[model samples]
Target: MRVSRLSVVVAAVVSAVVVVVGSEGAAVAGAGGAAAGGGGHEVDLAFHGDVTLRAGVVRVRFVPRNHGPSDLADATVRLRWSLPLVGVRRLPVGCLRSGGGGVLCRTGALEAGSLGEPVEIAARVAGRPAEVRVRIGTEWSGGAVDRNPRNNEQSVLALDTGDVYYF
Candidate 1:
């Protein structure tokens, strides 16, 4: 059989289209070129409840949802708390890994424990701050310990409640 110029062009176009379609669902690589997941998988984390520090014990909690294909690991939580009446001060909460199917964190404490009330609590991950109001109350009595020694900085999300709150 003889092939015409028009037939050749059509064949080429069809081949190109097939290649493009086949590669449409290609997997995306993560930090270390690891096959992260499909194009539609995503991870979403959010803070739902209030964090309360009482009786020398600090309690912190959150809700983390894995909307992505791969699980998140070693996610760091940065916390900054200050009182409106008092001057600005930065409280360091350290980095913590994820647990319980990428849901919560129970990291250590940034400050020992205080008998005062913190006016504001700001929690951040991947440099983005959470949209909820972090409530700090010292109903407990625990000594404040500095965890961040490199820059004399403590982990941004440390509380007696847990090592690292994942959600």
Candidate 2:
């Protein structure tokens, strides 16, 4: 059998395409030999916080940390409470009220291996419940891809006994 150069090149191209397609969701290393997403900079933001509910009032204190090799221009964090909000007493500088039981906050440009500004929010929930479930997650990360999302999302159950519950 005789082989042509054009045929060989075409075969190689098809093989490359197939390989790339097959590894779509697989853990493949990037161009720089790092196991990031699509060879782009990875930004991982982990949130640590504590919440206390007392006398129908809820207080939250949290800090975000970047654990990746890249810096993000900005990031958004979302907090949701199980009960509806009756009133907002205080919110961080870049934080805003969202809906009835949610708050969204923006963390200005965060560098890798650095901690963002501490956030504090105080609000009142409608009626009095024995406990409230608070969920924290990353809303946005400057369009960067995060490989590990488990650390960025957290959930906590805070009782009205005024004890701080850490997430």
Candidate 3:
């Protein structure tokens, strides 16, 4: 059977409409899946270091914040010093040696959009070592996804017994 010109035109228009509608539906479905996967569980970390220097001594308070839609559990913090500071001690977080003048501590659950309790670390200047620098960051935990990993680490110059701070 020979097809008429009008019938051919109608068929082409209907085909085009079906293809466009199908594509839109697929796009919507994919967006819905992504939203469900996120589930307000995206977590991000931000680090803040407070350094105190006085009389050949240094103290660092490492505060990490969870900028998240949900709370985080068992997050870890790491602190590293440039100098081989003597008399180093970690209070309350049970941090252990991480080699090369570094310490690590595990935090309890961090509330959503909250700053964690500061981890206190102090050390004595070892016979006029080089300028003190402290670097602090968060360690990854299982099943928790951090949306912004770049802000998880921070470094600061210790403000104690140095030309920068004291005379």
Candidate 4:
């Protein structure tokens, strides 16, 4: 059977799409590459309940879960860990290096059932325990879609502070 020119072009197009779709993101963790399944799985990155509000900092455990069967190459949690205490002269809680919209934490290539890292947000407070709010979700710019949007963002109140934390 003779192949038509149209068939050749169609074949090329299909192959290109396959290659592009197949490599959504390569594992940055060279050692973690073995766990990647290349199935374009979605990740659920969020913070667990009950964060620690101590000192001049608020800390939370960022959990990036792979609800899909396929393993993900990477995951990130962008959050405004803590807002400045009410009436306090301070900006939002800064991550390790607080900047703007929110702080960012990353998990490089989660191996199916893997726990992510702990993200700390430093807040400026004074006197009695300050009341602040922390938010977690996509970064200021953008990020991948959460497998579950309902849990994409979480906010908690940090009240009743003593001399434990400072600016």
In terms of lDDT, the best-performing candidate is: 2
Instruction: Kindly report which residue pairs in candidate 2 clash with one another.
Output: none
User: What's the best-to-worst order under lDDT?
Assistant: 2, 3, 4, 1
Models 1 onward score TM values of 0.25, 0.78, 0.64, 0.50
Best by TM-score: 2
Model 3 per-residue lDDT tens digits across residues 9-47? 999999999999999876655544435663334577777
lDDT of 4 at 37: 35
Runs in model 2 with CA error above 4 Å? Answer: 1-40
Rank ordering of all candidates by TM-score, starting from the highest: 2, 3, 4, 1
Computed on alpha carbons, the lDDT of every model, listed in order, comes to 0.31, 0.85, 0.69, 0.50
- Expressed as tens digits, the lDDT of each residue in 7-63 for candidate 4 is 999999999998876665343332233245323344555445455555555544445
Give residue 59's lDDT in candidate 1 (0 to 100): 38
Residue 13's lDDT in candidate 2: 100
| Model 1 lDDT, residue 116, Cα | 15
Pairs with backbone N, CA or C atoms under 3 Å apart (clashes), candidate 4 = 55-165, 129-161
Clashes of 3: 1
